[model samples]
Target: MKASTKNVIKSIAVLSVIALVCVAILSLANVFLKKEVTLDKATVKFLNEKFATTAPTTTGTDSDTAYNEDYFVMLTDGELSNASGYTYKSFKSNSSNYVSAIYYAQKGANEGVYYIESVSVGYQNPISVVVSFVIDNGDFSIQNIAVKEQREDFGDRKTQVLNPETFFYYVSLVKSDEDMNITDADIIAATGATTKKSVAGLNRAVTRAIDTMNKIYTKSDEIKAEINKRGGQNG
Candidate 1:
């Protein structure tokens, strides 16, 4: 065949491959379009699932969803002034660790428990997760991490940090975010996907939650900053 003819043939092949890839992507988009996943619904569903294993004990509340804002109060100077007396306090985040909101579980059997809501960036969109902490005698322990939203550019695989069998399984064994990143580095490596930014994003949020809780509960430097912010707001 002539060189020009060969070039034409190669162009055709390349076009065909591009067409096929486009079709495949469109097909996936169509399938995802068929299902509508809203953030609030997903959040509620995650909380419902988390609450199921929890026994109903809080007055006028029966499920884990009861831990919502209506059930728990936000932290104020009163709480800050008497921080030592309070074991848990909830506050809003200013994007620190990708955290948007943090709540304290003050209900029965849930005391010393905290819920940190992080909207971490994934491959393209944001991955919303609620990290829970169960503190005992000043020692904080992570418990049941609920990933409520995964709006990624590549569609939701729900396997990165959300994988319970692998990633989450290892995370469950970790007590602190530092341990998750350092002390239990082997475990995180064993879980795999730590190298991915989505996984790193999740880790960042978790670390922030753990660090924030530690600082808040222990009256760390963060307390001073938060107080200053709150004071400015009041002023």
Candidate 2:
């Protein structure tokens, strides 16, 4: 073969090898970076079904009514105190006000966890107070808890208190127990004082806040149910 022809063929081979290497690297990077996101729709549906199966039915027996009243009384007494407790001290100092809403999530057969998220419309910030419990034979007991502020941006300033793993860890603490119960002290201990600038706005904000908390609590039930259903099928 001519020397010029040989040189051209060698160059072509080198270029082809480089291209193959680049493609391989990209493929590996994509595989490594791919992450599993929210649960699948079908799995969520299955989980909801399982959760319902395992959940205790609410009855109107006198015992049941009394138990519920006891739980509510405990929560109400707690509310009478500063709704957010010491956690709201910072906001109070700055005259940065807040409004809170209580949210409940089922933890097990007779247990439910509560979360109090306070929103400061003045500063556009939200603080979270978590309380968990279980009700056994009509008694409420504390399980776990955490109080913290969420991330936010105030024009030139930005802040984040906990990462996703840590935040989820706090959430899991409340949701993992099967026999935890609710109590008045637990409710009082979980929150601090709340002040809303506008009464109507405060009412609306509190309602929405409670609803949001409830949504998150229900999601745990959905996940557990789905996992159980999938496990049963495999068995």
Query: Which has the greatest lDDT?
Result: 1
lDDT of each: 0.53, 0.35
Query: Candidate 1: where is the Cα deviation over 4 Å?
Result: 1-48, 51-61, 64-70, 74-96, 153-159, 164-167, 176-178, 183-188, 192-195, 219-235
Worst 10 residues of 2 by lDDT: 71-80
Q: Encode model 1's per-residue lDDT on 55-76: one tens digit a residue.
A: 5332235444543433332345
Q: How well is each residue in 23-45 modelled by candidate 2, as lDDT tens digits?
A: 99999998998532222332222
Candidate 1 residue pairs in backbone clash: none
Compute the lDDT of residue 149 as modeled in candidate 2: 37
